[model samples]
Target: MVDRRVHEGEAVIERAVVDGRPVDADARLALDARYGHFTALQVRARRVRGLDLHVERLQSANRELFGAELPRPEVLGAIRAVLGDDLRDASVRVYVVAGDRPRVLATAAPPTEAPTGPWSVTPVVYQRYLAHVKQAYGFQQAHIGRQVARAGFDEALLTTEDGLISEGSITNLGAFDGERLLWPDAPMLHGITMRLMERMDVPQERRPLRAADLPRLGQVFLCNSWGLMPVGRVDDVPLRQDGKLMTRLHEHYDAVSWDPLD
Candidate 1:
């Protein structure tokens, strides 16, 4: 769902280069204050579906990560202000790294579309220390994206260190294990979009998933703040492509109502 205009803006910025040896400490502090303390900030394009939900999640994560309430940083408001009329359907990403000051970036782009077929994914074994926080720690995601593109697949599905499928690079993972929809049950991160579906009475189980269990799956999908996107293929294994179950769940998710619980 990324807007064409925003993509163009990114390209323009990506090509630009500044000529300088970098700034001094005071200058750096001033810069960091602009973005806040977190390494990154993300607001779903479609999943949370509203501004209040995004703010709530940010505050919650801030409290959990820093042991203090969020300062109501202007980053969120800046996002809304900058995107103004241009934003209708889009996700926003803000990266704020700690240094002399914080570096903040904001991008409002379209949401991801549902996949067209079954999927194959390789899970990352280790977990990022701050899995509970939705910062810019996207190195694994970038690696998985490259791997998927090289292997001719759609995306990367990640499993927790304990062998349970936790989530995708940018989405949460859900699979049917003959009886119910199984989601990783552990001290893993809870996604805003995933929580919405759960609030809608979508039956899900929290359990450990093993490599040996892949064959038993009746269906598989990736869910995130954007929405649930069906997997079309996995590694070398392929599942049914019509994606009836996934499609229905997706449609139901779209029509259902919601209120943020966090």
Candidate 2:
């Protein structure tokens, strides 16, 4: 069963809401086991980066999965109401089940910090169905991630059947060639942060990145709605750390303006 309270440090925080109503442990678990589509975003001071992109993501997923169009305004209103007067940093998850209307779940927590150290990733050959949709069913990814953790790796990076790197279990992967950023030309979820970076005029190229290309890449990074992070290693091979590239990427990313929810 999903716990009603999320224990973070000394604070007990409410972590689930269904259709604008707070969900107890049982309800949360019931929803957790069901198939649904979702989008996760970080909210700080009542604002979010790429809020429109997140909304569009939900709308598109809802239409594709349920044959129904999601009302964006209502979802935003529900999120605002759940947040109420306290607009501190939090994690927001908007979910859409098949039978029921979309639900907005949130938890009070500090924003995710960018990775300071490098990460070690193990390649796993697996592909997600409906790769563009951010569905709630992530059992495979979670299971693979756990196995990788047990194997002394930080995360699992999914690859195509032919050994082309697709993305991380929960994040989008990008490679740096010392002069430009290259994204894998594979079927994967287009991350909001990655879209923002592209809009900010970051030089990027989308092409198939295979396992053989890892050694030649100067740097590797992972990105999602939360932030951009540096990847230190892929499998047992170490990747170069380019501080200058990370600095430039962060500058463009941080420049993206946050939209106020209220």
Candidate 3:
């Protein structure tokens, strides 16, 4: 289940500011040629949920990709500079583009709400390159996103060739076996929202969940920055949904304290 959300209106991205300054056309082209990593956050009322996690994500990704950590203050400053006090309730993304040096591009767009699913997904045999770090748009992820959209599915479920499940195209996958929650043990981004839910004291464990075992779960769900949603079906396999569990998860996630920006 790709975490890309449906905007309340057109998703218009504001001008991007790199390292606290708006870039020109040539600079924009320069950034396009470089390798980068990014993290998208939802800013609600000048605050963000999992703000520390978001920053740490950038810090760690910067270290892995650029050979040095982008300081936390600089990351915060870039966000503030780009947002320019105009974005209160909006979607803001901090991008770390690597050239001879690294640059942080902070940009904003319309805020998004989690898809209220009952979303259907089709499982495909695939794995992401450098899957741990949230690298910029990978070709395979985008390809599958388009394929599922054209194939009449809500999202694409990713599994290994041997049928061991890993994750969704963008969202983190979870399942309940009528008791404890199970997150796939395979390689995937340990998303911020997924980690927040883990702190809620839910009975959960990280383990290998197989795609062929879907029918045994009492509930199947997907989560990402937008929010959590129930899975209606995996391919042709109709899975059960627990409304009460979903309500509990959503409430806990929403109850997460927000970190103020500016």
Candidate 4:
């Protein structure tokens, strides 16, 4: 586990022993300093929106990955214990990972100041090796971020080898076809935002999407706990940059009720 400093903070490391000889001190310290060696989780709760969805998803993910059922109470207590009242009307993250003892970090920060105009994104094909859990065990997604950043885009929409759009690197991708939003027709990771919308009976089509279909799309947008974002372009394909659809969805999403477990 890792956390932002609530007060003064110091980086800690675990040393290795080999035949009674201390393993490379310099290398271990450097690794510990850079990573802070903690689990990672991203959460957002503006006006208390989608908080339960986040916690429940985390619980389910924990059970799926660790076989140890991490309770919502434990998760929330850690957040409140560290952040106190600072969590009000802000995005909060609680990161915990295994070390000598679990390291916990609870941070409250403003959400990403999203651009008012529609943004563009490229769809990249990649698979998450671990199907569940938000542990910082790998950097595949970080590599995806670098790839998208290098391509000069706001995000990357992940897809399967056969051309089914799965999700974004950090957000969930939603396709618009003049009237409805479409998710992947096949299996894909369930996103909190996407699940919330589905539960609210928001009209969404679960179907296969093809890259060649981009030219024919009326609009595109990305959704996540943070917000619904309109996509103005996809690679070289360009479209008008109004976020009307995204706005409509966000409005509906915000009106829904969700109380985080206290």
| lDDT (Cα atoms) of all candidates against the true structure | 0.52, 0.74, 0.80, 0.56
Better of 1 and 3 by lDDT: 3
Per-residue alpha-carbon lDDT of candidate 2 for residues 1-262, written as tens digits (9 for 90 to 100): 1011211111244455667776776776677667778777788888889999989998888878778788878678657755767656777767777445545544344455555577778789999998998878577776776677778776677898889888888788887776678999999999888788777565679999876687688888888765888888777888889898888888988898999887
Two-way TM-score contest, 2 vs 3, winner: 3
Instruction: Tell me which residue pairs clash in candidate 3.
Output: none
Can you write out model 3's per-residue Cα lDDT over 1-262, one digit (the tens) per residue? 4343332112566667888998765676568556898887888898999999999999999888888978999989987887786767878878888776787887777778876659888888998877888877466786787788677787778888888788888888988665577899999988999888888766788888887677788888888778888888877888888888777778888899999987
Clashing pairs in 4: 1-96, 1-97, 1-103, 3-105, 185-207
Give the lDDT of residue 54 in candidate 4. 62
In candidate 3, residue 189 scores what lDDT?
88
Instruction: Please estimate how well model 4 matches the true structure, expressed as its whole-model Cα lDDT.
Output: 0.56
Best by TM-score: 3
Task: Give the alpha carbon lDDT tens digit for every residue of 21-138 in model 1.
Answer: 2234455334433423231122343233534545666666656644545444554544554345444444455434444433334444454344443455665665655677765434
Query: What TM-score, computed on C-alpha atoms, does each candidate reach?
Result: 0.69, 0.90, 0.92, 0.73
Q: Show the lowest summed lDDT stretch of 10 residues, model 3.
A: 1-10
Q: What's the lDDT of the predicted structure labeled candidate 3? A: 0.80
Error of 2 at 231 (Å): 1.1
Query: How many pairs collide in each candidate, listed in order?
Result: 19, 0, 0, 5
